[model samples]
Target: MKIKLEKILNLDDGEYRFHFETAARDIGLGLTDYEGHEVFDRPVVTDVVLNKTSHIYYVKLYAASDARFLCDRCLEDARHTITGEFQVAYTDLKSNREVYDSESEVRLIEIHKANEITLDKDVCDTLMLEIPTKVLCKEDCKGLCVQCGANLNEALCEHAVMQMNANN
Candidate 1:
């Protein structure tokens, strides 16, 4: 959830890679899906790349996690993989004031006093935005039988047979 800049801060212009795996809740992403299933029950895996160019640093964060949810159509337990990637830039300056620009995805920080950077908020927002609007067990789900309340994917219900006979 946090990247300690003690090493990267001193290194010259280059790309530094970091990898970590942590619980989703640690990054403030303990959430539930539309069906109330825990969306972040699995651990979040993150890969970070920091590119230092003189006083400017570019950061890219890639995060992924497996989530469990109830199929929207069949109402059965299903698994989904959620992923998010974000990029931001930071400028290290000797100025006393720190500035953040949401529109530009950039921030200015005082490198002399700062030892680390927290990415909890940025990770949370990225993962949350990637949650699927609709979840399904498969591409084609038969769902349930409206008349008999039975899972149509398992088997055809008597009501369906009767309705088909009536129609014919």
Candidate 2:
């Protein structure tokens, strides 16, 4: 979604809110999407809070969606609800200064001569950061047996259990 800040730039200092949506293509999720999940293809809801604070634009982004992934332990289908929040600062006014104020502490984006900004990259990066390093179907998921290659959770293997007890 592209948001035009031209009108907001002309207005007096204030805050504004805008709601936008994006498809997989817009967020660079067309191929090898976020964690290789097809669910990212669905439209993602994005909320932007634009606040004008002391001539600086503070942008707060919120995105939420459900993603599917393969469980690492049991090799089963797993679903996780992902919610990401990000903050950025931008100034529409021209500035020749090389350094920005340290108080804001957000990545500064130059949008002085631009009428709109596309949030596709931001959304993609936010969601990508949410991808878990390890995926699991459950906290106590019992994985498959090494000896017989059987699902330990579904059926207990007598030999496997005996071997574990003996080793302990």
Candidate 3:
């Protein structure tokens, strides 16, 4: 959602509050196109504080989503809860370029308008960071049968092979 901060920019020192619901699909993170189960019952909330003089805006976001992941070990379906937090600065495009801090992780946003800002990209970035690299049903889960391509987690296969005696 786009928030208008024209009023806030007009004042010497002021604060503005905004509350809105933006669709995940609009930001390209919709469950329909995502490679997993749908995300249900969730919305992204953004609370921003804009400083008129500094031309910098501080944004805080909270979001949650439900996702289904394939277990790395058992190959079973696993449900995961994805949540994340982000703090970023939105600066005016006309401001002098500042050197990035090597010691800290800070995302810089170039602001085009003094009173309007879009939170779509920020929300999408936070969700992407929440995705886990590896997903497993359990730590000790048994995988699938390599010979018959059967899932060992459900049942054991009956295929057997004769073993050669090692004793001479």
Best by TM-score: 1
Stretches of candidate 1 off by over 4 Å are 34-36, 94-103, 111-114, 166-168
> Tens digit of lDDT per residue, candidate 3, span 139-162?
767777667766766766653121
Which pairs of residues collide in model 1? Answer: none
- Expressed as tens digits, the lDDT of each residue in 1-168 for candidate 2 is 777767666767788898987775677855443456584646778899988766677788998767777778767777787779988777644351224545554544466556676777887788878888898889888887777777776877986779779999
Ranking 1 against 2 by TM-score, winner: 1
Per-candidate TM-scores read 0.85, 0.76, 0.59
lDDT of 2 at 30: 56
Across 1-168, the per-residue lDDT of candidate 1 in tens digits comes to: 777777667888999988878888888988876667667899989899999887667889998999887889888987899899999888776331134454465676665777788787887889889988899999999898887789988988999788779999
Name the top lDDT candidate.
1
Residue pairs with backbone atoms closer than 3 Å in model 3 (clashes)? 5-115
Which sections of candidate 2 miss by over 4 Å?
Answer: 30-41, 96-113, 157-168
* Total backbone collisions, model 3: 1
